[model samples]
Target: MSRAWMSGRLFGAGVIGAAVVGAGLIVPGSALAATTCAAPPGAPAELTRVQDAEACGSTTDGTGGAWSLGAGGVGFADAVDGATVAAAGFDGGAGAGESRAGRLLAVGYGADSLALGMLDEPGIAVIVTGPASQAFVGDADDPVLCEGNLAAAFNLTAGSGCVLAGAFRYVTPSPL
Candidate 1:
């Protein structure tokens, strides 16, 4: 794939290109095929930790058709294990003729993890956004620490169609 196409795929814009390459639906050495992200040269190996949790809440908009928010979860990998964690929740309404009239729920790992320079690594930063009222199940093999570029994302839209849940895992370099 070309450098321009690769850049678009990394930022989540090249879905079709990625699908063609990922599913092996395209021929090898094709120019339009999707390309994966590569790590920067001379990047330092670091230790990482994965953290995950879930919560429940509700939202109000004074409309007759009230929307309920519950079962929220968040997961993310951190270079620094055992660091204090914080979470936030949000909700909004459609203006009038918006086709995408729905609610948005998001969770973010504070700047401490990103500030440590871990976020710069390939697949180190993770964000999952989807429909509201989703529940995520925890993985049985959860790791508290990992060595390498830990890639983690959560599907918050599961269970009861309105519950929110999250899971996080970290990757770091293994000790020699």
Candidate 2:
């Protein structure tokens, strides 16, 4: 699987498999859902919406756990492991530090997952807001992000409905 990622075979775990089908990106018919970015607990009320959408760049790295498009900080981590650390805190402390506000945005599934299996289950999660370069994961073809799919969870639309990409840090963890 790691080789596949290096060869550009997979993306955003599995939710994203975009290709230049013509001049447009190939978005899976059943994969995308509009999600809502509500104010997470402990977050100041002024931040009603904290983030926006962005495109993923070249696949510089690959772990392979595959993050649900809707998953948020520490939201999907509980699904894989019973524990989590905030990812938003790269201010100084990094790497498993509890101070950072982060979540499990992606995981290894192929060779990378196989490698991770030898020891601990490795997962990567980004924060709720940031520049596109740091906020997205995937090649430029399709950037997998947690915010783009928030409409459903918040019911931002009339009746689009929410799809469980993973868990919402602002809320509790729920399966998709």
Structural RMSD, model 2? 17.8
Among all windows of 10 consecutive residues in model 2, the one with the lowest summed lDDT is 110-119
Question: Among these predicted structures, which one has the highest TM-score?
Answer: 1
Q: What lDDT tens digits, residue by residue, belong to model 1 across residues 1-176?
A: 89966664454433323322432321223212211111111332222222222222222221201111111222222211111111121121100000011212123221111101111111211122232222121212221121122112321111011112234433322224
Please list the residue runs of candidate 1 whose C-alpha ends up more than 4 Å from where it truly belongs after superposition: 1-81, 92-127, 133-176
Positional deviation of 76 in candidate 1, in angstroms?
14
Candidate 2 off by > 4 Å: 1-3, 8-86, 89-121, 130-176
**How close to the true structure is residue 130 of candidate 1, measured as C-alpha lDDT?**
30
TM-score of each: 0.18, 0.17
Residue-wise C-alpha lDDT for candidate 2, range 3-105, written one tens digit per residue: 8554432333222221112102212232233222222333222111222331111110122221222212111211222313222111111111111212232
User: CA lDDT, every prediction?
Assistant: 0.21, 0.21
**Cα miss at 153, model 1 (Å)?**
2.6
C-alpha RMSD by candidate, in order? 19.9, 17.8
